[model samples]
Target: MKKIRIQCALLTALSFLMGLSQFIIVGILNNLSNSFHTSIDHVGVLVTLFAIVYAIMTPIINLSVGHAPLYKVLIILFSIFAIGNMLTAVANNFNILLLSRLLTALASGPSMSIAITLAAAITPPQKRSWIVSWVFSGFSIASVFGVPIGTWISDNLNWRFLFWIIFILSIILIAILYRLLPHNLRQKKGHGFLRQLAIFKNTHIILGILIPIFNFSAVYIVYTYLKPLLINKLGFSTNNVITILFLYGLCGLISNQISGHINNRKWTKTLVSFLSVQAGSLFILFLTSNFKWLSLIAILFMALTMSVQNSPVELYYMEIAEQKYPQSLVLASSFDSIFSNVGVAIGSAAGGYTVNTLGLGYLGLIGGIFSVLAISVLLILNKVYFQ
Candidate 1:
């Protein structure tokens, strides 16, 4: 019990740093743009490229390295992540920064998926879902704590300094994880990476993956542009905008734990309900764009519900995969991570396009449309898969 607790805590802290590193760029986009002498939209493309690389690399690494010992693989991959951050910190041009992002993305996708696998492996079967939640809540914690700090640092210091911080944190975590985890942790040798692809033959499995894709797309379509919405649309000072983001992140932290604690029997219903609420919140966000106070409440609601839905959806998918296609968890996790990156990649890109063409105010309606689609998929999953 003590061993598992220490493992979860260290893994959670590592994931927190992962989340922090990924999101710091969003908070410091203005700094990057100014530093690179580029447009904000152009800087936004960095996110798209990073996600695309992550999506591309996740499966490749999983396929090739899934058979390797967990602790050793993680240490090696984490080292790559640290190196990538160092590269970014030293980058003098946009192209170099872009390349550095690709490097980090490549290592990041596999590292995260493996971390999830490690978390599941180290715990009791029934407690696995909660462990996953606790591990991933590190991401929410990044939003709650790290983003605000990074934003403040960017406002006061050089943007490159943020990557330097990520570099140091990554290196430090490697040591911490080494101390906490056993060496050479290994999984049941599944048939192979190619066999993992068979898990998708089941429509339910495929839809399970798609649920989060659409869900993330829905939230990120607007969220990717949140700073602009708060600053330009709602007439918030930068510091005030950060404050609202802090509130939003706080709500997200609350939601992350909420999903993990919900009764397992309620997983599907909770998922469907949250998707519905997300759709409604997004619609209200669109309609109430002109109403500042209403929009603020809407943001909080969206962030809270948006985050709460994620763990349930992911837990459900992993549980189903574990039961139905037990040996293909590596593959399932790989695909999950791939689609997650693809979802955010697509969402951020679409959001960028919407900002350019349709304007940020319409982002909510567009997001709501996707939210409805996700809900529709979940309803079908419940009917076809669960029932």
Candidate 2:
């Protein structure tokens, strides 16, 4: 158990770097704009580009490398990741910086999918979800700690320095992974890339992927626009809002930790309850928009339920792949990462439309609708499949 925990911890650190690399851009957009002599709006494209590339590249890379030993594939991907960061730090122009980001995005997706696969490979069946939850926490931890620290570094030092830090850390992780992962780990028999695509035809696989899409879309609908809502509607001062955002992130971290212990036998009820609470809290935020403290509590409650579905849903995909589609394990593991980006896009667009059409106060109402939709999907999945 101790050894399993250590391996998961290391993989969590790998996830932290990947998450930090992807999200830290939001905090340093101004720095990037200033350094590259471009508009902040233009620099914002970097975020969109990274997401698109990551979503498109993950399964492709997984398919390409499915036959390779997991350890070697991880090392190779991390090495490319290190190079991407290095390129980001040294880029002299906006185009070069964009290129660097593309390079990093290409590596980031596959690294995470493979890391989850490696975690499952190393751990026992009973503990796979626990280990996978730890892996997911890496991104939560990054949002909670790493992005803020990177923002601080950008404020005090230079944005380039932050990538340098990532580069150095990636190098360290590569060395650790090379030494830590077992070389003799069995590789599942490879299916042709076209053959693996057949998994998507399975109703269970498609619905399993949609759960994240709807749930994440629900969370991001309000979350993506939270700072604006806090300032424009909730009447928080800018400085206090930063603290509140940090507190909200801590709630997310706690959410992930709590999710790790959820048992599979009880997952259907647990997932439904969590999503129900999430929907209710969003509605509470809607009702309490005029009441400052109550609105704040509702927002935190939403955060608390935000990640409850992640571990169980991901564990479901991993288990399904292991039992029914072992050859597509890496491809299956990549689904959450890929679709979650799609959800972000959908939610952000929906939130923007709502804000333009209705107002900030209605963001919660819109988000709650999506949460309810997620619940509907879960019910369908349960009745048709789990039962």
Question: How much lDDT does candidate 1 score?
Answer: 0.81
What TM-score goes with each of the models? 0.96, 0.89
> In model 1, where do residues sit more than 4 Å from their true spots?
none
Superposition TM-score, candidate 1 onto the true structure: 0.96
Best by TM-score: 1
Q: Judging by lDDT against the true structure, name the best candidate.
A: 2
RMSD of 2: 2.7
Q: lDDT of model 1 at residue 195? A: 74
> How many clashes in each candidate?
0, 0
- Span of ten consecutive residues with least summed lDDT in model 2: 39-48
Per-residue lDDT for 40 in model 2? 50
Error of 1 at 92 (Å): 0.9
Off by over 4 Å in 2: 28-45, 90-97, 231-235, 286-292, 352-360
lDDT of 2 by residue, 43-100 (tens): 6567666777888898898888756788898899889999999999999988999999
